[model samples]
Target: MLKQTLQQKLLQKLSPQQIQFIKLLQVPTVSLDTRIKEELEENPALEDGSLANMNEPIEDYPDKDPDEQFNSEESSFDEEFSVDEYIQEDDYKDYGGNYNGDDDEERKEIPIAIQDSFFEKLQNQLDLLALSDKNYLIGQQIIGSLDDDGYLRRPIPSLVDDLSFSQNTFVEESEVEDMLKVIQEFDPPGIGARDLQECLLIQLKKKDQENPTIVLATRVVEDYLEEFTKKHYDKIEKQLGVNSEELKDIINEILKLNPKPGDSGAVAGKQLHVIPDFHISNNDGVLHLTLNGRNAPELRVSKSYQEMFEHYEKVEKSDKKMKEAVQFVKQKLDSAKWFIDAIKQRQQTLLKTMNAIMEYQYEYFLTGDDRVLKPMILKDIADRIDMDISTVSRVANSKYVQTEFGTFLLKSFFSEAIQTDSGEEVSNKEVKKILEECIANEDKRKPLADEKLTEILKDKGYSIARRTVAKYREAMNIPVARLRKEL
Candidate 1:
């Protein structure tokens, strides 16, 4: 048995409007339109249109208090209300949405590949065989099992089981293997290899086998693959009795093989362009920041919806159906206002957060130099913008910025601090940039090791450890010295 007790406590629960604002804030410029379209379809009160009033001046919509929170409970129809009391008089500014940017290509341009899907082409190629219905179904099942890389990774037993249960046909593994061998001969040279080695061999088998280089290359791939991948040229030479020049040609031929056969020969497919969430420009040493809002559709309360709400409110409070209609209209209106306000808050927060980041990385953005990036973290921007670190992270994580040098993810600019010998604070990005340069300029025959890299950084006044150097190298996708070596 439990005893009743009185207690005082505090709890924090996200309101629906607050949750919507958080979600909208985190959405990048690329997905804003889809999200807005979803809301438009879900709520008839919301519609895409010009939020900018041509008749009213901009000053008439006074800047809303960013700190103010939206509360849906406050809009309950059961409570006493007036026509002017519920109307929010939407405060969203159309920044390059429907009100502007009539020519910005709608924030993205994904070139649609006018061709068959990967599996479809493979299926078409499979159809040419004209196998029996059972064999064709088995082949179709096999084709469906292949991954995007064109590799059939599933075990033979698994395929047999799938076909037995799904196709109502029981077949042995040999039949499936025969069909696979037939489909592997399709176009693209390496359509049905099971692994990297198999993929390479399939491609090379399609090539001229009579060439001396081809013969030697097949030997290397088939026998000395381990040593060859490890760049153990000494062991390969000792075993194969080949000189450095001949070995180089052999290694080059094997290197040209496509490891992932599936990526190649897409008949037609979509290539999505990187739609930057923000744009930073250097105008004669001064920096300017602008949010890419071409995909942000304009949204507001429907005028007819508002009129319907008013007409229902004025008629009567006694009729049950009329009151229900009033309640429904009020709910829709509240939802519309909440979404509009959330969008406005999203814009404000994006601008606020990005402006803080731009100002924080002002020096680097000015000249597109990684060395000039100041040591910054989520907390720094959060403090600068008077927001939480989580909010700042949401802004930085999925966002991209277009710069003079190139498009960069916002997360790239943030790095931990490293104090120099001179007792001055510097960004780890600076050290990484220097580390990248050293590797880029080093001799590939004997690339610099992490210890040597650490010493070089220490010589330059960065007290980074060998482990830290390795971490940076790995972060930049650079391999170890042994892997970087070449003949």
Candidate 2:
């Protein structure tokens, strides 16, 4: 049997404008222009630059009660609709006049120099090989199987299967393995190895035959790669019958080889350019922050679209086509207004959040010194700006600021507070700096261990734990003490 019951539940949903705001807030200065161009294409009512008075300040539209605007029926477009509801005389105030007239800035696009990609380089080498058409196709298939790190991650059987089904060619695993050997002999020295050990061995074996150290280096990679990686030099020396000095020479030869051979060749026009979103300038002792506006083009609602809506209002309400036209115009106009308002709001919010950040880390900005960076979090900036933490995070992500010293991601300034032995709270960044300096100055033959690093920091009044020091070291991409060892 089925029973019916009345249930009450509360639901929270984002409004269309709210959703639009969130998406816009996350777009960095480099990509904001692209987003704006997309909006312009989708909404014909939106226009670039000011069409009204240059001195007028542009005001946001849809100033009416939202409950009324959203709840109203489409039929009301014919009866109660008025163009004035969408556009007010005061809406065309600040036009951001600098973006207007012949003063519009033009940027030149420089042609990128073409270069071969990793796969193309591999294929070029494969082409030089004298093989039958079937073998040639098999070789091409092998090249396709290599990952970005220059390793053949796929199994040989899988390549054989791929050739059987996809290429309509039957081939044995032995033939694929044969061709794989040919590829592994390519210019990169380790272009098609199966693993790290093989990659190193391939490069080591490719060295000049006259070099005596190659034999020992090959043995170390082949027999005791684990010991070599763990820095157990004594064990490797005893097992290989090589003294400490001889082991050092062989180790030096191994270290000279490229681990990721595929990375050597340049790919055509694949370089990514980083554009910082904010600029910080220091004048004497004060810091000034300015948002990068190169990508954010000035925009406004099209005057023709506004006039068309007004014209539709004068048409007969009894005509269904005319009523439909009015509704369409109204929707486009509303979208244009919402989009424009969103862009302006995004600008204001970004400025507000970045200004708060610049003020909070004023000392660091003035000196470009990481040590002076105060302890701060998303909540702290959010509290200062009177905005949500998510808003601050959105600004921090994918955004970089160009300082007088260097460019930095906004998240770099934020750190957890660390309590010193003196009971004073400081940024964990300070502790990390001290730990880094200690590691840099340590003897490579017997590197400072994490326990010693912790003790050093403690002596300096940092009061950091070994585990925390390890975490910090790892965060900076520093290896453990054992891995840091060298001859």
What overall lDDT goes with each candidate model? 0.79, 0.79
Model 1: runs farther than 4 Å from truth? Answer: 51-111, 130-134, 161-172, 265-268, 293-298
Native-to-model Cα distance after best TM-score fit, residue 59 in candidate 1, in Å: 7.4
Off by over 4 Å in 2: 1-10, 50-55, 60-110, 240-245, 265-268
lDDT of 2 by residue, 210-273 (tens): 7778888888899999999899998998998988899999999888888888776634466555
Once all C-alphas are superposed, what RMSD does model 1 give against the true structure? 5.4
- Model 2 — TM-score against the truth? 0.87
Q: How far off is residue 443 in model 2, in Å?
A: 0.8
> How many Å off is the CA of 370 in candidate 1?
0.1
The per-residue C-alpha lDDT of model 1 at residue 387 equals 73
